[model samples]
Target: MITIPREIKEFIELQGIFAVGTTGVNNIPNISPRIFFRVDENVIYWLDFFKHKSYKNIQANPWVTISVFNKDDLKGFQFRGIVNFITDEPTKLEIKESIIKKTLEKNSSEKIKKLSEKIEVQVIRFEPKVCYSLNPDEFSDMCIGSDVDSTQLFQK
Candidate 1:
């Protein structure tokens, strides 16, 4: 298990979209944009809407990576780890609450909001194993992997 840095968590909170990378056949990697996610400590959870190709890929391979860059400066962090899916009622209730909150914020149609809240969404829990700070100058700086060291936080 690895701990995600506070700086990285702050960066993630400000962004709405994050890209998740998963491996497919022949080790080909597939990246998809995720819209609904929240980071809690070292754990990240997201609503898996539609259960698309990426979902299928995760079923085949547990290893995955997430890339989140601030849209303003393109500076961000990459989180690598394995994922666990949550289909329980608690997760569903959380998703419903999130949807309702967003709907209220956006002031969208009540009927639409009602339908959205009813839609089944899979909750994905990710345990981060590694994280790398990204930038154009250094590219890879401030890395935290499985083994927590002086230079890094953890190393797998």
Candidate 2:
């Protein structure tokens, strides 16, 4: 299991949306934008609100990938792993709290507030099997893998 670093976690928190990728048994890929997501230790969880395609895809194939980036800085992290749908009370409570917290933040729309209350959100958890950093310094744009000690990748 790989542990997410503090800097990466902080960067993710500052972002408004995350891109999640999943593929079905037929190998058709699906990407979706997610807002209600939280990372804890080695697990990353996101709330799925009426995402029928994503829900169906994950059910067919457990493997998934997540791409997170700060467009302004042009830096990002890509994570690949296995995913599971969790409907446990504790995780559901966490998702509810996240929705409440985001609603309290600036520029939250009435639609978002209403959706939070009405929708049946599913908590999807991702356990990272490997991580890669998208670095553009090289001509080919090298992607450093975290399977080996990820500390080396963080050390500048």
Candidate 3:
């Protein structure tokens, strides 16, 4: 079983970049960096254009894992979930607003537009089924416990 703690939730929401992993039909794996938002306790959302190998892999296989961390603390969460592609107009607008708010704060209009054009902003929603959190100091001894497998936690 997987557990999600408050610390993990807070860490995921505060991070700017997360890595998403997907597997192909033949079981080959791919990973990509994504800018995402937490829609709820178990759901994460990110935009992807029709382009990109990640999107193609998800379309072929909805199983995926997302990982995020705090750079300063090195504490983070690994999320395993099902992927859903969303392209409705209202969802698109919501995504646009989110992108504008999150990106425009530190970017110029030209840069924003260029990025917006490059991305059609299809939302990739992840509904987490399992989660693993790392706290290097206090939990260092627990790293090798029989019940916990760090390698499997991050694997797709």
Candidate 4:
């Protein structure tokens, strides 16, 4: 498992949403915007509100790439990882509460309720194997660490 650098960890945790990419057959990928997501120290979790294409793809292939980039600057980190579903009801409930809190901060109560109702509530726990910087130059200036390749954070 790859240890997340502090700078990258803080940057990711501030994100309200993420782009989750899952590959289909022939290595084609489907990328989707997932609003209900969180980045932890060593893992990332996002609620699959619907059992959509990404969910199906995860079932077939656990490997996924998740990214959160600045719309203006296009600077961020992308992580590649293996994911497994969080089946425990307790953890799922906790995640729900956290999501509700986070969502409520920036959304109306009615909207939050509507969003909550639509949730299939499938929580995915991603254990990242790599953390690649979006820009090598900017990444260096951040002075995060010497260990990160800034190009490729992991070895196959």
TM-score of each: 0.76, 0.82, 0.72, 0.78
Model 1: clashing residue pairs?
Answer: 145-154, 145-155, 146-154, 146-155, 146-156, 147-154, 147-155, 148-153, 148-154
Per-residue lDDT for 1-156 in model 3, tens only? 234456565666567678889987777889888753444544667777546788888988897988777778777666666788776889767866786566556456785557656645677777776665555655533332223464575455
Superposed Cα deviation of residue 9, candidate 1 (Å):
1.2
Q: What's the residue-level lDDT of 138 in candidate 1?
A: 57
Model 2: pairs clashing at backbone N, Cα or C within 3 Å? none
lDDT-sorted candidate list, best first: 2, 4, 1, 3
What would the per-residue lDDT of candidate 1 be over residues 1-156, giving only the tens digit for each residue?
777767777777667668999985557888988656677777887767667788888898877889998756968788778897876788667854664465446556766555456566777888887777776655485564554452543234
Cα RMSD for predicted model 2: 5.3
Better of 1 and 4 by TM-score: 4
| lDDT digits (tens) for residues 42-61 of candidate 2 | 88888787858889999998
Q: List where candidate 2 sits over 4 angstroms from the true fold.
A: 103-107, 138-156
Q: Candidate 2's error at 49, in angstroms?
A: 0.7
lDDT (10s digit) by residue, model 4, range 67-147? 777766667887778899999899988976786677667666686568777746788898887666776456523423333
The 10-residue segment of model 1 with minimum total lDDT is 147-156
lDDT over C-alpha atoms for residue 74 of model 1: 60
Selected candidate, larger lDDT, 2 vs 3: 2
Each model's lDDT: 0.73, 0.76, 0.67, 0.74
